[model samples]
Target: MRGVSADGDAGLGIDLLDAIEALKSVGCAVQAVITDGVATSIREDRRARGLPRAEWVRGIASQIALARRESPNRGGRHLGFAQALVHEMPHTLAMLRTGRLNEWRATLLVRETACLSAADRGIVDRRLCSDPAILDGVGDRGLIARAKALAVELDAAAVVARHRKAVSERRVTTRPAPDSMAYLSVLMPVEQAVCLQATLGRDADSLIATGDSCGRTRNQLMVDLLFDRGTGASVASGVPVAVNLVLSDETLLAGGHEAAQLQGLGPIPAAIARQLVADAVDNDTETSLQRVYSCPQSGALTAMESQARTFPKSLRQLIDLRDRTCRTPWCDAPIRHHDHIRLRRESGATTADNGSGLCEACNYAKEAPGWTARPVHNPGRTHLIDVRTPTG
Candidate 1:
């Protein structure tokens, strides 16, 4: 979308998005060069996050430099994570200025657009991820804006989840300034926080605030979660495995440095762990699973889709408005993904109106009768509110 010669010369700023889109039209590689070049030159800086947009430009520039060397057709060789970084450019710049969005959210945007391969990863890093004008040409402007907003909300929850975990683990560090030590808050909808604690095997902290600074690190935070919640005497019914889960929860929940360990999950030992979860089965908690299984989504292969009559979109939006921290109504764990109610292949209409989001355990607990079957009162939209007073 920048400077291209009247003689059909390559534009300086176009990236693969421009190149590939044009290739579909012109059927030429040179045009790909022209378009791709124009896409990579300009970059935007998101100042609030302290990340400069120039890094993108530099990344793309590196690709251009490489192409000028070995691959004149501009093929082969990856730009490493730098190219992978291309997916996040727009949101990163937007987030730096707002502080409302973060890195993981920004990266989702970058990767979503990275389906094209005309530009090398190196080039993508420089051209598409770097340039300011690239976002202008993105299709479905409304969709892009809406998706970004959703990602921001999700990231905020993750941040809070991490913070609370940190406090529970004693990972927080402290240093006094003139007035006070710089404190961090893990803000969450009380319901979500409550659910996360249960998933981690802790009891509850209905009204958690910014505790000491030592709760910042991940390992410490998770350990603290276990210690704080399970500090009291162990009951006779409690199994050692349950206590171990408490330990694991603490180890996993602590945020910041130790988070990677939690995320890098290895194979589950099928013996005791599986038996524990399997034996845990008899209690039944399918409310959350069934709710999610009943929802809809974008990945559908069908003909006669769910067409809303009265309201264009279905009034029941499960994802937008969660009913509980636990899908089973009383079980625990923050929702991770949707468990389609109607099977995707059964010609089920793909819409949020058809399903709900749920955690894995509750979602898979269909062995018990009525496990996945819940009494969804009203079956449609009606405002539900609690009479409880605010704690936070």
Candidate 2:
């Protein structure tokens, strides 16, 4: 039995070099696929087998994410996790190629690249192509240099942003979804909302419920008002101004403003904005024709009322202390309003333990669900802030 000669060909002619060559070929083909775009599914079953383009791309983004520790087989992370990264590209290539990112940010981009699959690289490239931060901050030349540097380091395994990853981060930038209804909704409802609305306007509508609160936000419409006011508020003692008039190229030139966008507030000039303010003040207009059709939804309306009202006496002191800042670490959002971890309508106690301070951004994340302020232990003992990474 010991002499059965179990090995094939008595271990005679296995070409190890040939096997290595084959692997190199396979890697090359895969690299091409990653660098180029993939056609959308022409057949449904094809879609079923592989991850959807979005999901596939997202899965490959693992490179950008922190590699798990104490896992089974980890050694500086083999390239097994992500696909598109083999090509060293991102959804926002043009921006990345421009040196818009700082050193810390370059590493962050590398991590993002780790998550994309070969098929998803095209998608990522397009998404990031025109990112203003990449172009403006990192600059095209800088991004290209960084991209080249990263290619050597990561083999195009991850994205490179214009800023450092350590500068600030969000939860929803890369993940699939975000959690909402946490903070601001629980506190200063109506008037603050009104002020925010007046200050930000249409852009507020586009804030994704559970995503990051930065980037070229859909809130440009909202910010434009602030920009207009920022440039000229001194003339009116910082009171909210109103503007009413048809905006045209001529008007834009007259007001020292230009085109801008985010998710909302399409476009209007500073001069026109000021003119509208003057018109509103002169007429004592509470609502414009558009306003009649643009009233807050029942949910926002109710929220506005509750927020405008005050923090219950029992909760005031608690809110004042725990939330000295926005409660979202690194965010300096003022605690203008007190919010309950759990809202009143949900039968939450109107007690000190139920309160904390939050700025508008965090408020949106929690307000909908009405956070659990206290029960087993108070919400503030955590002395925590809401900080998460972005998914999309």
Candidate 3:
């Protein structure tokens, strides 16, 4: 054969794209049929028994199993996934039909919008996929980011409420893995998880740097510390690992209902947090309390800097207590550095208002080409740092 002709290869690729588009259209049509069938069966069953319309899709597990040939639980995800596209996100559904969006992309739209109201989701679908050509080459990451950004921009309040509900449902679980390993999952609020990881890393780093040598790598050391604590044994390094909690004075002193935030974790119930604070004060000689004042409307906290004006451990603690995590939006990494939102060379003050907590990665990323961050002043709202990316 002559060397594969580039023109012929390009033609074949175009033909494959056409075939995939046809498959996507067929998939959407088939899903429509399956959904209608499920609805028809549910309606007919309800009519025979005089059940209400609201209850029609409630007890659908058996019918779903019989029709879909899968577990009802899995079937339900598909059913709801399909229904959402058909009803709320017709623009996205149209993209699926036109082969501009694949099955997974369409599914992603449904998933990320699960927290949104039907009307808001429809708005997002119309905004993002109204013109199917716009989604031609957008990967999953871009699609998700676009969807989430739109959702938050349109209705930050709703997103906040959804997050609060999710936080309430956080839990921990475990499962077996390959090679006699196990996976331990702690599904808690973002801040809590960040704090735990940061604490472990801090202890591990300290041990690695000590005059006494530990041959184990940082990763290995972290695991050892985790296991030692889990098994009720002291960490071998003998350096105290402290986790700070930022509690409101009202909650700490008067036993109010306001939940205190654990330094690395999110909110803890007022009563239990108070008890922990009391225990710490009584037990730990090194425990020092920092008074934090927060604005009533926005809950943004501010604390006074040290008398020496030094960015010491105390100053780091203050920023951590104030920001609670990295100041970068959507990046919840624990605060590893106190950074100036305005660069020092540009006359950025070193005061609390001009300072923010940022993880090391984000801190470094801010210095990368075309990235800029500066604090904004909003009269009624808390101070915000506006970050502009290279793309922006």
lDDT of 1 by residue, 1-392 (tens): 36543344345335554544544433222323343543333332323435554433333322332334422112212232133432434333333223332333334444433433323323433443344455444544543564444443435454355556655665323222332112333455567668865754332232233443343454345445554556452222233332111112222333222111101121232343334434445443121111122223421111112443221232233342343233433333445445444445554345544455455544443222222232223433332222110110
lDDT of 2 by residue, 27-48 (tens): 5344334323321222233357
lDDT of 2 at 77: 29
**Model 3 lDDT, full chain set:** 0.72
Best by lDDT: 3
Evaluate model 2: give its lDDT.
Answer: 0.39
1 or 2, which is superior by lDDT?
2
Ranking by TM-score: 3, 2, 1
Q: Is candidate 1 or candidate 2 better by TM-score?
A: 2
Model 1, runs deviating above 4 Å: 1-320, 345-347, 367-392
Instruction: Write the number of the candidate with greater TM-score, choosing between 1 and 3.
Output: 3
Error of 2 at 185 (Å): 28
lDDT value, residue 92 of candidate 3: 82
